[model samples]
Target: MVDWAAYTLVFVAGLITALATGIGALPFFFVPDISEKFNVGLWGVASGIMMAASIFGLIPEGLNAGPWTTVAVGLVAGGLLVLVANDLLMDADIDSRTYEEADFKKLVLILGVLTVHSFPEGIAIGVSFAELNLGSGIPLLGFTVPALAIAMTIAISIHNIPEGVAISIPLRTMGVAEWKMVWWSIFSSLPQPLGAVIAFGFVQLAEPLLPAGFGFAAGAMIYLVLSEFIPDALEAGEELDGKGYRELVAGFAAGGGAMVLLLVVV
Candidate 1:
């Protein structure tokens, strides 16, 4: 028997994290020009929060589960899933020119790509809720919530800011209304709640697999930070400043250090 209430709460948490990305789009509403420096900084913050959450929250939870082999396998599987999705999307010849210029088919393609991009984030949120009243000791909404749930929620929300900005930049150029940008950004992340519910259900059904769930989320996120987010930040910064590499390195170090400190303290 599944605990419906716990699943609902986890879904809500994931939804809230997804919605927080909308906040990043809000800046475009007032500020016509968003500085490149600001974008880099936002990425830095996102990276920091994600790393902190993965290390302090997800990995630790995974360790609580049985053998290391389970976690290792889950991590590799999660990363491979993202890679496969990326390959499929990249192979498709979807135009990335303009949102308005894109036909319905192109829009669908874009959404598909976005889904691959966002799924792991949703999974992280979902897996974090594994301990929902099952054992862990944090309390929320009349149930004993896992601390990892709270941490993942906060981490994902912070990480989404840069993503929202990335989405808004294109929409802005396409002359999409600011509010519409916010809506679309939120729309891009809509899968999170569904992911959360599914993951929570899985954990509830297979309690023993909870640790693997944690490792899956953590591995996916850490891989993203290393492979995609950091590289994107550096490239973006390079285009803006001749010494972009320096800035990228500084930002990465600072972000990673901050996350480490947070983990240590919290």
Candidate 2:
């Protein structure tokens, strides 16, 4: 009994996050110049939001659904998934320029790298919707949407904005058109809908694995925040005062605190 309607709704929710990435690129449309200080802050903000979502939303939810051991296993497995993917693609570096200019074979390679980047967010969206319409939640359109699902979706969508800014930075350096920057930002996240559908279908069938699923998504997401986002922020802030540590911390506190508040509400 595949609930096509639910699947469609979830996919659309995921797509909304993907589209939100485009919003990051929108600032370039208005101004040809954006300060590096602002860029560092943007990365810091995105990292904070991601870290908070994983810590507050995903892990606790996993614990509530099942034993800590199951969540631990999922977390370890998720980290390993990222580790292995990075190891495989260690020599292959893809950047915004590569995104715009890559031909067929090159395109395939970059997409593989991006899978490691984006799929976990999709999984997060999917697992949050595990209960879907079966439990009490907010009604939207015609379906009873889970509150966690809505929270996770918004969290990811907001995080994607700064991520879009990061992506647009290099493209801006190359003078890529504003619309193309937005398109490429969205393109990077296109797999999310499929990832969401797959995770949703899997959890729906194996209800027992819900905790592990939550752990898996949380683990991957947090790993990314640590390994990728934080480092990127630091690298961007290398020339800034205090090496941008103050800005990073400030952004982290703001982003995490905001998500915590949202979690409290929903």
Candidate 3:
């Protein structure tokens, strides 16, 4: 009874997002360094895409599938999970710098941190595809892909590019090779496929929970955009006169517009 084929498609979608992180490191092969302003803009762009996807894509989908109350509960639960994970890992924080001298235990700790950060994104992709083979959707390559699924996959892929850049910066400064930088960036998000498959399976089995799944993914992403993404952009943009708010806003508009355009086309 298991739709292994559909699951395979979902995993592939998640894998695509994870691989997208590598794109960030490709520029390093040609340039000595990326501008801080550009990095800030990337973060802003990521935040904008995530926020738009959550608010316009996920939340509405959740409402359409089930009651608003259930969706609210899911939102809270999703936000809480992120908050608690951060709190738990607050002291366990390790960075690219930590790896050079890290032991096996330390390496495991680093991976755990990366997994926590990237897992929700995978979940969002999975939740978006909950109706993958169950209902009417865009047909492609013999699969009924939800429009939201395509949108989330694209959104998450774009979002991960900045994350890849962030991961690569420290490695680049550490004299790591460009190819290794790309590899490490991809590794940071490697847990995505697992998260995607698990979430997709859960929603497909428990149909009633579909809406909550949508809300959970949306809530976690939106919270991350606010609490982490925007602040990061601001921090990186400090040298920009009058702050990098302008660049940040511009990036946001562009990212959001891209999502809107994709949705319209799909």
Off by over 4 Å in 1: 1-14, 24-31, 95-181, 184-192, 195-204, 239-242, 257-266
Residue pairs in collision within model 1? none
Tens-digit lDDT string for candidate 1 (1-266)? 86777777888898997898798789887877646676565556556655666677667757776577887877776576556655665566666565433333333433443444465567667777776678867777799877878987987787666557656654554467889889888888888888778767775554566667667766666666665556666766776765365555565566667666655654
Q: Please give, for residues 119-197, the per-residue lDDT of candidate 3 as tens digits.
A: 6567767878888866878997798898889988887787677556655654554567899879988998987888889
Q: Assess each prediction's global lDDT (C-alpha) against the native.
A: 0.67, 0.73, 0.73
**Superposed Cα deviation of residue 150, candidate 2 (Å):** 7.9
lDDT of 1 at 25: 88
Candidate 2 lDDT (Cα, 0 to 1): 0.73
Clashes of each: 0, 0, 0
Which residue window of length 10 is worst by lDDT in model 2?
A: 102-111
What are the per-residue Cα lDDT tens digits for candidate 2 across 27-80? 889886657676667666666766677788778977987899999999898777
Best by TM-score: 2
Between candidates 1 and 2, name the one with more favorable TM-score.
2
